[model samples]
Target: MTSPSHHAPGAEHLLTRVGEVLKPALTHYLDLHAHPEVSGAEARTADRFGRRLAAAGCELTHEVGGHGVVGVLRNGDGPRVWLRAELDALPMRERTGLPYASRDDAMHACGHDLHLAAAAGAADLLARLSDRWRGTLLVVGQPAEETLTGAGAMLRDGLYERFGRPDVVLAQHAAPMPSGTVAHAADRVPMAAAGAVLDVVLHGRGGHVATPHLAVDPVVTAAAVVTRLQNVVARETAPADQVTLTVGTVRAGTAANVIPDHAVLGIAVRAAGEASLDRALAAVRRIVRAESAAAGAPREPEVTVASRSAALLCDPHTTGSVRRAHTGLLGPARVLSWPGSMATEDFPLFGDAGAAIHGERGIPLVYWMLGVADPDAWHRTTSDGITSDGAASGAPDAAPPPAPNHSPHFAPHIGSALRPAIAALTVAALDRFAVT
Candidate 1:
């Protein structure tokens, strides 16, 4: 791996420009956090991001695949480096209590708002230092990432064909770790999980609740299925194989006095490999069918696989290069090795994994986790202190753990996190771009 001292001559200028663009980047983060849109409905978010890219002198294109935005910056061609960030938010409410927190039903609970601002800041800095580097820059705002569908959607819509295939794709995600730090996977797989989302409908006969003997209740069957799903991971899956099955949503009757004709369930499964994921999915289908049969329902249960994606694996060579660049920019202490996670992502589709959609392969991808937690707040919660119950303790605060991704309380310390994130992206892209 290359050392920080061996960075190109332009690296110092890139770091200096990060401070110059911090103010507006923070303003953008605040605005995005206050107003967020959910998956497949990111018109406003896309527009805001597109305008930022345009202001940074990128030739912009909109609506590549369901509100996806693409911006191109060419400074004499060398390596085409793509910096990708998510545009859509989660379908949940924010409870961070920040003055600029989302007031609507949707929330940027996953730090996508932070990601966008950082990408925009990097775009501005890179464009300003255009003469120092030679290459094309592709800044992409992808939508529907919460549903794990946006990357595939964009690829299917000819992301590479229309905008030109990239030599490398770089992305970063916000994590609960302390601010001013970045973590890269130590293994080949950055995210070691493949997942599938399932939608199920249970059918039965409806009648008055008083005449329970005459009516079949699908709600009962749905409950049974949910209970049995736990056994799939606990008893069926190998202990070494990491797997999780969750019934996220369940809807049944309208009135308590009346039995509903059907009940619906939204199921999600994640596993370390495709075979484990397949087995878990199969088990889910079997449990649903058997429960419906046991309930003596008039019709069989319906099951549909809503979305799925393969495990995300980073290009080892590319990742090592970027990791070294990050070390050069942020110092060795701030750059850490990441233990592979079970979090699933559709980002794999942007590389060789989605050869079926893009008809191309060998596009290197580099992803790292950006720390977003406030150092003081994080230390307060993690330090040994008196327990809430008035007892002395040596353990971290247990009353309220640090809010993680997808949590209603998840909030990034923008002041400390934003600049590092921008610098991380800028250095990684600069490392790939030819030094003029």
Candidate 2:
């Protein structure tokens, strides 16, 4: 059975014409996949995207924020559509072993490479079909998304002021779903959470291991805190609230014989609600400090909020219109309902219309997931009821599960997904200015 194809009343032929040049766009995606750069250091990646946007004949601006690029193409006067793509690679190495796999230590594990290529392709498509719509096209190449600062950096650097505040914002991310499909979550509630990276240091008195009582053992206190934190969500949080806490790292003494003077914990906390996130973070601080004080620590534990990602909420009007536009481009079968995620994204900063953190306001926004998993692998995982992403179990050898974003083995079937991704994004952008 063939998936239904839908497009604007007059865009079908133009979109088909756009397909003729999509091969180069696919090649560009592969090229980006091969040459990955890490966040805050995407000079080479930025250059490539800038070149592409320039080739598409847009008024281009470079380095609004660190390595962030913006391109504006003005038509007549209509709704200004904003599109965005991430340009950073993860620090991890790629193990996909594809022909175009990255040789650099950094890898495009999160599919920012694909996002860049798709955005480039969408720009190309829209540029080619300029006669069909009248408005301005704004495309952004963002940096440092892994650290959750790129969107904020761009905004703070006068993204909306220099360019124009979008009538509607459209962006997409790569997910572990089957190739040739998309997942969308457009609702009043955030599809993803907002939170911060927590850096905590527990101070203690260093002393001989033989005379443990003489030393205020921070390791013991840290351990106890971790144990108690297990019940933070289980006991302290109300059942109605949504919060998840992950203590990703813990470091202490170097030598076995001597007790360490201090212990460090790297925590990631997120929640769908701002109040929930605040409460969770407060609990984290209280737990660590109280544990240290109870252990007779010489100083209070230090807790710092490193980075905060505002929760993601897709504007209902934008989301609904984009969904129908996507359905018109692809079939209903190719577009699936996306389950809300606990993952945090900096993309929220672009659409902080609801005052997510402090007092930040942004344009209306819509973000969806582009499925990238191999069909068979997706089927296997689905059959096995593997609710977790393939790499989440930390069991690479357990089974040949599909590669999730940010995994070493993660690789998008760029060839298969590129055209549809381009079509979907182009349709969504044009939909904002489309006439009935």
Candidate 3:
């Protein structure tokens, strides 16, 4: 990667403004970290984000979708650029042991809090530097991203029609890499997998433990289905294809002696494309029904898709421009190239994949990865054979890697990460704005 001769226009001023806004941004990040709400229930999160945007001179609108917040700041006449951040958190306990960790079950393990803070900071900078550019800035706080339904929901609620069609939409996700670094997909597809979450119910007859011969055990059938589902990827899918089937939850009888009347299963499937995902989903349904029948089930098994998302494909031209802006602002060393992953996201809905719902097409979308791991901690664990707890390992080469997104131990080093995150988004948006 070659370095740029100079920074993007007003890059130095943007950096200074980022520092000026860092205090309140950090405060917001901490408050959000301490009070996270799960998907479809982000009332507090949305309120805080909307208030911050309004404070930064945006025209705020609440509940575009379920608890979605949209803030628009218009200067003169130019392209409308939307900056998006997630509002929902994961339903998991916090184990990071930080000073401001959440006391409840929900936790911001994926750095949505960081993204929100950065967005707030960027909004403040743009509002403060209105004289430098001319455009409409749309700051969006999206809800239910974890369930992969928020983006579509917002579009169905007329996000584009109500506010205005965006010339470009920008977003970023937190990664486990060293803080202050940003990564963009080299192949144009930042996330290459389409995914679906399914719920399965198996029905059977219940009976006492003594009358085992008369009773049908749905638990046993569920186990058999889970075991057979593994073959869907191993034996059914092509060797070159990428597919994953995870039976995340299984529930049955409460007592060990009693035979369960029915069993419930929560399953997830991911694949490189829609065809592969459909094939795997079909295999799951077939196997579930077959296993239930083989086990003398009382009724046919039921399967339903709870949520689904398409592969995230970023716009090449827009991504290239943002990448150059990032390189110019942070230098080539901190702007890294990313190999696409099997992760799936609903962000594609903002582009062509969701034309059916939003009645719009060719809207460019740009997504990137933002590093949130502490450099010292990451280096100590991966290079010096030290654990995250600051303990020296017996074998340095076998040290465990840094905690990843969704882990209970995941924590971002805010001191060094916040400034860069703010500047990254601000510079990218400024790159699209018409210069004065």
Q: What TM-score does model 1 achieve against the real structure?
A: 0.94
Q: Give me the runs in candidate 2 sitting further than 4 Å from their true place.
A: 1-7, 10-18, 207-215, 253-258, 353-362, 380-401, 434-436
lDDT of candidate 1 over 1-436, digit per residue (tens):
2222226455545566798889989988999999999999999999999988998999999999899999999998688989999999998988999999999999999999999999999999899878767889999999999899999999889899999989899999998877877888765654547999999999999999989889999999899999999999999999998899999999999999999999999998998888999999999999999999999999988999999988888999878888888888878877877777777888889988899999989999899988888766665664563233212243644345468889999999887899888988998988888886
Name the TM-score of candidate 3: 0.94
lDDT of 2 by residue, 111-145 (tens): 89889888988888888778777788999999998
Candidate 1 stretches with Cα past 4 Å from truth are 1-15, 384-399
Better of 1 and 2 by lDDT: 1
Error of 2 at 206 (Å): 3.9
* Clash number by candidate, in order: 0, 1, 0
**What is candidate 3's lDDT per residue for 153-212, written digit by digit as tens?**
899999999999998999988887777788887655545578999999999899899998
When summed lDDT is taken over every stretch of 10 residues in candidate 1, the lowest stretch is 385-394
What CA root-mean-square deviation does each model show from the true structure? Answer: 3.8, 4.8, 4.0
Ranking by TM-score: 1, 3, 2
Task: Name the lDDT of candidate 2.
Answer: 0.80
TM-score of 2: 0.88
